[model samples]
Target: MSPLNSALFKNTTNDNIVHPDYFVISGFAGIPQTKYYYVFLCFVYALTIIGNTFVMFMIYIDHCLHSPKYIVVFNLALSDLCGSTALVPLVIDTFLFKSHLMSFHACLTSMFFVLGFITVQSFSLAALSYDRCVAICFPLRFNDIVTNKSMSFIIAILWIIAALAFLVAVIYINKLSFCRSNVINSYFCDHGPLHLLACNDNTPSTVMNWACQVVIFWLPVIFIVSSYICITRALLKIAAASERLKAMKTCTSHLILVAVFYLPLCVSFALGGALHMNARIINMSLASVMPQMLNPFIYSLKTDEFRESIKKLYRRKKMHITGRNT
Candidate 1:
């Protein structure tokens, strides 16, 4: 459709208008031996999907984990599985299959999911922090405040709010005119590069973008930090050394998760927007997905209940195999 003819686009002339067939995603275009990068992406997808699935499965089958805490972790694993699945396959295709021919609507859809997952992750992490805060700060009141029914209600509201923010974001972008270039510069359809491609006056969308960022990014960081501080204070007040250590132990996995997700993202976005940092931005963008790979291991290695459940599952499997042979 012509940019001028379309109702969605603002005022535009023929000089800044060309509705190309599709956008070319030239990922790693300047680099040699592109097939090697494709191979590595394959490894990333394989590990991410498999490990996250195992985490979900273990939580499901283990009766010991039928509590609010495990349920929250289960949702995070689900988000990781879905978020990686949504972006990575198409990313591999764009790298290997000469993916310079994706439709405009397809590009928007990919961008939506990529950002949508980040939105889900933001809410998920905040929910996890809130749960931890209640448990650690109010031991006696934890049962009343953090029950399974209440947790479900809170998660529902968090998801609804996040969904609305991303929906508004996509609608805002869709209203703009894109006549700048049909070539996107990232591995996938990130919102930043796509926003840069718009030829229209993008002040509205830019403001909305920042609004969404404040809700989905900065708010979660503030809440997570505040929750951890209270948790730390609570841990310090324990009368015995062993009790304090035990209290701290329960929080270790969550703190690791917060660091794994937030730190890389903050650094990547901060430096990615800096002047003369093209190489650093691309490397950091690649690094952002590393958290999905690390999350399963972090929970499995550090969380006692999950670790014990997995061991019990393994012993059962081994005994079953031996029995069958006998």
Candidate 2:
């Protein structure tokens, strides 16, 4: 064992399991002038919270919006809200407040919630794509195919799957002996960074890392792409040019959302080895948070129903204020 591993193993319990008291988060290390970056993260978090909340509130109050499609939208908004909550504030506390020391259990808990919500967010986008696919491809049978109850069931299953998967990953981390460095090199207590700190066999965790990539990233992306292809084929079948445009219009928001969320990630993954550590971290961080901040705005502006709902709500609030003044 190296000197660092020897020092870590000195804290071993009677059961021969090494558990460090706390981990030093080194994500922002070697970066200069990060205060401005922290401020920007704060701004992004605030926008994500406000925008997602507004979308959810609009869907809740409008009976017309309480359909299968809106159910998927509402699920996306909720996941964005919760995912940002899980990640940003803790990030602010860790970096901005300079509280980089996280306890072992605390680190695991953070890992679970952050990764769990991210998993849900990824699958939620896939669910939204499925909604669009059904709506566009089978317009006549859209209601029969996708209902409120069914959408709710799908969302529930996604949550359960994400929770269980991350929970198992965390359990695996708990079992590992951290006899190496206690410093995690990611912006958060990420699975790869945490598992790499283990001095014992980490093959399981390594396998889980690839498994998570398949579940959280690749699978959802593939599903969304396939759904859009089906939607395109359906649109091409429409004889009238006007009808084709109308059908294609509805998918614009979803397409933009997919691009916004996935493109940055794709770029980062493609250039991973070429970029410096700080640059890679910055790119990944932006990719994660920017999508949540942008989703609500995209849906609000692009979806006719959501935009109308917002207008109705605004008029109602304006009239109420005028009445009070009178």
Candidate 3:
């Protein structure tokens, strides 16, 4: 069988479709080795949905959470909601319906939105790290520096940059003509999967994609790491044990989020060009899913305030339900 035919059409033996030419060079990897893997994905999806939704609600209903810091958190939670929801449902559809085929437009739209939100989320986290550094290291100036006006500006800038980054990608994609092999290997349409369909001459899009990765992913990650390092060092120098502990808690949570998010994202986007088509798909899925699956839990579990907020929200809900019944 021809490679194009083999990739686009389902193989009876593999029971999965192959990567289309518009995407990357390889096919997907890492189907759940056991039933447990499927269960785990479902669990991640469930928690991601619930956790992000609840976080949104907390920020929405609580007037107190309207501060600059919480605004950043709200955006992060929103991104996580969209990012995970965009991919997981499609993945579930694949598993449940055996319907792995995504329409061409659906594939394109999904790829664009997923990449866009992930980029925006990275920027938001970077902003959050800066906000923490300022709050902790310069407590007196935190309010003045991180005002609502400035916060809105920062969020707007981040979204603009993210939109431009993805928009450039969309334009690049327009240049590539998909001659054959439109089947996407994985459950969702990522840039890698879309690139495989391009004719052999996919240089412009590939280069542009790399450029976006560097600017959109690594640049913010570097700043986030460096800012946190400075924040941690400053906290250590302080004399009060209690104060130091508080700083440590905040800094640690932000750093953990930065690492979890950037590491996999960098890995996946980094491998976008270099790896073979099949291996790239595997790497892409790994990179895309892990950060998203872990994001909601990371933020909720790591922060005491967020956890308490979630608890209170749930308790209120429970009481409301009981009252309705009574």
Q: Each prediction's TM-score against the native? A: 0.89, 0.95, 0.78
Off by over 4 Å in 3: 1-36, 183-187, 265-287, 308-326
As for candidate 2, its clashing pairs are none
Q: List lDDT for all candidates, in order.
A: 0.78, 0.88, 0.72
The candidate 3 region of ten consecutive residues with least summed lDDT is: 17-26
TM-score of decoy 3: 0.78
Tens digits of per-residue lDDT, candidate 2, 229-254, equal 99889888899999999888888998
**Angstrom error at residue 249, model 3:** 1.6
Candidate 1 has its poorest 10 consecutive residues by lDDT at 4-13
Runs with alpha carbons beyond 4 Å of true place in candidate 1: 1-20, 272-277, 322-326
> What would the per-residue lDDT of candidate 1 be over residues 134-171, giving only the tens digit for each residue?
98899999989998888878777877877787778777
* Residue 47, model 3, lDDT: 78
Give lDDT: candidate 3, residue 289.
Answer: 62
